[model samples]
Target: MSFQRAQHLESINNNLLDIKGKIDVSFEFFPPNSEEMETTLWNSIERLTPLNPKFVSVTYGAGSGTRDRTHDVIKRIQKDTNLSTAAHLTCIDASKEELIQVAKDYWEHDVRHIVALRGDLPDNSAKPHMYASDLVTLLKSVADFDISVAAYPEVHPDARNAQADLINLKRKIDAGANRAITQFFFDVDSYLRFRDRCAAAGIEADIIPGILPVTNFNTLKRFAGLTNVHVPNWIHDSFQGLDNDPTTRNMVGASIAMDMVKVLSKEGVTDFHFYTLNRSELSYAICHMLGVRPTV
Candidate 1:
């Protein structure tokens, strides 16, 4: 490598070494739908548990099987390991009573933290809570559980504008959410701006930046489209012509994620939430790059 490239690598190494033990992280996962996927998910959990994530969350969707699977995974994690697990709860089609029972069941199962969400567009006949803020309120009523709600750094797709986006986030926070885990965004500046706006609006809850380690650029683009997260042209160029090279793609993914974490660390952001997408190696490597090595 050239002298300038060598210097850059040295700087990154120094940053990683300096931040040892200061970085706190959590991970997000969806419930496995198949026997094969379940094995993969457990393998991931076993690999990542040694890194000591603050919590691992299981996501719930509108489908009945998805909901059951999510609860089963959360309960299994709680029973099978020493890790703290959080359940994702959504107010999509369920009534308040049904949601209450679900929360109660989680409490009884020893899960106390919840990632409350409004879920996807509700079925036309479903009517109780309308938004995430309402879900937050319902969770608060059910129990004094540690609650987390989602925030959109680039603004939610359905939001009219940025101002309205912040307003919705504030509502969720005001409804007793302990902190907001942001939807993943590539631009660190967008996250910083959103943080500043939250402060300006007097919303003091923690806004943890969600980091997505992209294993596939195509999948990332599809998600970006649905979430209104702007995909900068540079990101496309970075992965150009590596479609057939999985190993190089993984390396690029790690490099991009490590760079993003380093920039956020310099900005004084300590906590991060990784959307693991049921794959552990990339996230495990990124956390290791951030100086969070296994203790067990």
Candidate 2:
């Protein structure tokens, strides 16, 4: 999906009026652990706000460790900026009523968007649950809030297969999910195929491809291993032996991500959600290459 190979790039750009040259963009942020980190996250938000993202989200930590902090960060974003804020909520480590109250809190606080999930359990937590008291039950309980559920493009590490994962996605949408956000993938083909499968399964929602700018290839590879997201050999080759040079590694990272986004733009995708990993340079660079610019 090279830029030159795309015949519809011009027409698509003209037709998708909401896209800013490339289209709508959103960002993902995790809650801070201290005052210094808080200042940093806010600075990051301020930097990206000028881009006028469709919305910005705060991530919920595994097993709900950051629940209060996540809410604080999100409410702060909504209060301090013009950006629409979405707070992530997970079903693990809580009961149904607890989940309901969280949803209502967002509603009362003038926050209408939610990124809902059944987050993974702690490592020592021998047998984690699916929040399966009923996945449908939980999603419906939160339905009054516009929620975006997680979609595993490579299929969830734990899911039986790609098709089985789609079936679970269908269940969530049927239970009133408004959208889905996929785990980040290096291959556009993985996302494209996932999109087609979602369509065939009768699940309709904005299935936004999540992009991760390689902050630390070693760190990212470790995380991908934990979640079962594969790092293709070719992608590894792009960054091999560059661990010693942070500057060069970042440049290579930005270029590779830009290359992927350019192809996706050609495939008629206009919306993107970036996993900032609490740093802005790589994501900012990649976005610039895709025609996203901060206002003067």
Candidate 3:
């Protein structure tokens, strides 16, 4: 091989080898709707548990049925695994009395952590009776639950402006959240800048970066559009013309995630949260690349 080709290969290898020290990781999973999906969810959890995540969180949905599913899954994970588990609680359609009961039930079951969110409201629906900050306060009243709230690096779609969004996050933190897990973004620099802004605003909470490994570009574009997350033109070009090629798409997606982790870790980010989407392969591979491995 040419000397330049050898140097190029070594450079790529060194980039992965350059990440120093230990990295902490957490994962997010959504509740399953069917027996088959539940099986898949458990299988994914089983696969990732050995990596020893700091915590695993289950996402909640809008209605009673979905809420029940989230509760059931949280209880099962707490019962079955030695891992720390968190349940997602939203203040969207539920009354304060109902939410209080849910909090009490979770605390009674030894579930001590919650991801408090003001869930998405439907069009034409009345204004939410409670926001995430109110939920944080309410949860604290019931128990000293370890709470995690969402942060938007790119401002939340519904926010009046960036400063207003930052203030809202501070309110949640001031109301008693432990840390903030950001919405996933591909641009590492955006997160770094947001972190700087958080510090300037007197917010001292840990701002954990959320990493979503993309397998479906079209689906991601739609989600990004709704959430106001910017998809760079380069990402679009990378996934172009690969709709028929799942294997290659997976490879490209994994490569992108691995690179993002490397950059963020170098920038003093020790904690990462993976949105597993109920599949473990991509997250497992990325964690392995970061030297997060199972212990004997």
- What would the per-residue lDDT of candidate 1 be over residues 61-130, giving only the tens digit for each residue? 9867889999999999999999999899998878888899999999999899999998887554554446
Give the alpha carbon lDDT tens digit for every residue of 1-296 in model 2: 98775856765455333334766789999999989888888888888888888899998875455899998888888888899998887767777787778877888888988887777766643565654325446645655667788888898877878777888888888777788988989878989999998898887788988888885789989989987788989888888998899998899888777767767777888888999877777777767666688867
lDDT of 1: 0.91
TM-score (C-alpha, index-matched) for candidate 2: 0.87
lDDT leaderboard ranking:
3, 1, 2
Q: What pairs collide in candidate 1?
A: none
Poorest 10 consecutive residues by lDDT, candidate 3: 13-22
Count backbone clashes in candidate 3. 0
Off by over 4 Å in 2: 1-20, 62-65, 123-143
Report the lDDT tens digits of candidate 3 across residue range 1-296.
99999998898778777773368999999999888998999999999999999999999989999999999989999999998999999999899999999999999999999999999987644688899999999999999999999999999988889999999999999999999999999988999999999999999999999999999999889989989999999999999999999888888899999889888877988899999999999999888877788987
Each prediction's total of clashing residue pairs, residues at least 3 apart in sequence or on different chains, is: 0, 1, 0
Higher-TM-score candidate among 2 and 3?
3
TM-score per candidate, chains pooled? 0.96, 0.87, 0.96
- Residue 1 accuracy (lDDT) in model 1: 89
Badly placed stretches (over 4 Å) of model 1 are 122-129
Q: Output the TM-score of candidate 3.
A: 0.96
Give me the runs in candidate 3 sitting further than 4 Å from their true place.
none
- Residue 13 lDDT (model 3): 77
Among these predictions, the greatest lDDT belongs to 3
